[model samples]
Target: MKDLACQQFQDTVAEFLIRHQSILDIISKSQESNARVNRAVVKAVTHCGCVKVRAEKSAIPPEATLADLKQLLDSHLDGELCPNCREIIESEMGKSIFYLTALCHSLGLSLADVLQREHEKVSTLRVFNFT
Candidate 1:
């Protein structure tokens, strides 16, 4: 159960960050009494970028495959993120997931509930597509 929570938290953070690419440079901290988790997430996302860095959202174009999305990025970024950023993002993401998993253990809050709330916030933002 704990392991699943960790994975879910990681996935949720990735999705939210991917959907909100403009804030990639910002380090979002928790406003709750405990901020360690949020700080971890901010660090992780910074290091790895998103699994799927959708530059902008449109309904998935009819012919697009996940590979295409990744391939596009590979061709574009040259070789994913630089080494330093990758390390930072991975470490931060791992820390954040661990904290969130701990929250699930202590507070009985489902990862989905927290992730959903975060996604709701992203859904409301205005995203501009340039292509």
Candidate 2:
């Protein structure tokens, strides 16, 4: 619940910027076209500061945990992104969702349970606030 609480805070700021006329128009067009443009923009270019893979053969390293991600990123960044910065994005994207599952091992809640609880909070807040 605490982790979910913080993610909501980060999402609020992102939603605010994306609510602009030009931003919303771009999002709407991508949705209408059923294009990967929206996802590429949001996931990589917007937040992660990378682009979607342009070639098929080059592989991103397998990221199953924060440590795994750190290794993969370290190999690329060479200390460019500080540890704190890396943690923030990974937590936001829940990029290593598999890591979340591992972290939740033996816990009763499923991913669906976690998502529903988090979504419920967002749904209740029509206007985003960092409460």
Candidate 3:
């Protein structure tokens, strides 16, 4: 079901992305979309004041294990995105996904397969994946 949705989205993007058919265009647009997504998050934090980031160094004990690090670390994000900010963020994220899917289409890759492989890797590796 998820794969079907991904394929449908990819097909839609391939159909509509007439102007950016070149690989270079697709790559550049993908980067631009990612930047837009980042900008939206920054706007939410800086302009909206709905969310605050209190990032700081994590103070881990000398005796702490790898699993204990998860409990000690924090995202440092405070509060939730207000409706307006949330909408903007979601729209920007959608554009990112669209361009990502377009890239996959241009490369003859399946976004669903890529997501599934990553999911399996993380599930199997668990906390050790990053390390």
Note the Cα lDDT for every prediction shown. Answer: 0.49, 0.45, 0.94
- TM-score per prediction, in order, is 0.33, 0.28, 0.96
Show pairs that collide, candidate 1: 44-92, 44-93, 47-89
Model 2 Cα lDDT, one tens digit per residue, 1-131: 75675455434433543332254453453344333433433445346654333333434566454445444432232224345445555554443343344323324345556777878988887335333
Ranking by TM-score: 3, 1, 2
How many angstroms is residue 26 displaced in model 1 relative to the true structure, after the best TM-score fit? Answer: 24
Residue 73, candidate 3: Cα error in Å is: 0.7
Q: Sort by lDDT, best first: what order?
A: 3, 1, 2
What are the per-residue Cα lDDT tens digits for candidate 1 across 1-131? 65476566656655555322333222232223136444444443555554323344444566886655644443222235556656655766665554444444345566666766767666765232212
Pairwise TM-score winner, candidates 1 and 2: 1
> Which tens-of-lDDT digit does each residue in 20-94 have in candidate 3?
999999999989999999999999999999999999888999999999988999889999999999999999999
Residue 129 miss distance in model 2 (angstroms): 4.3
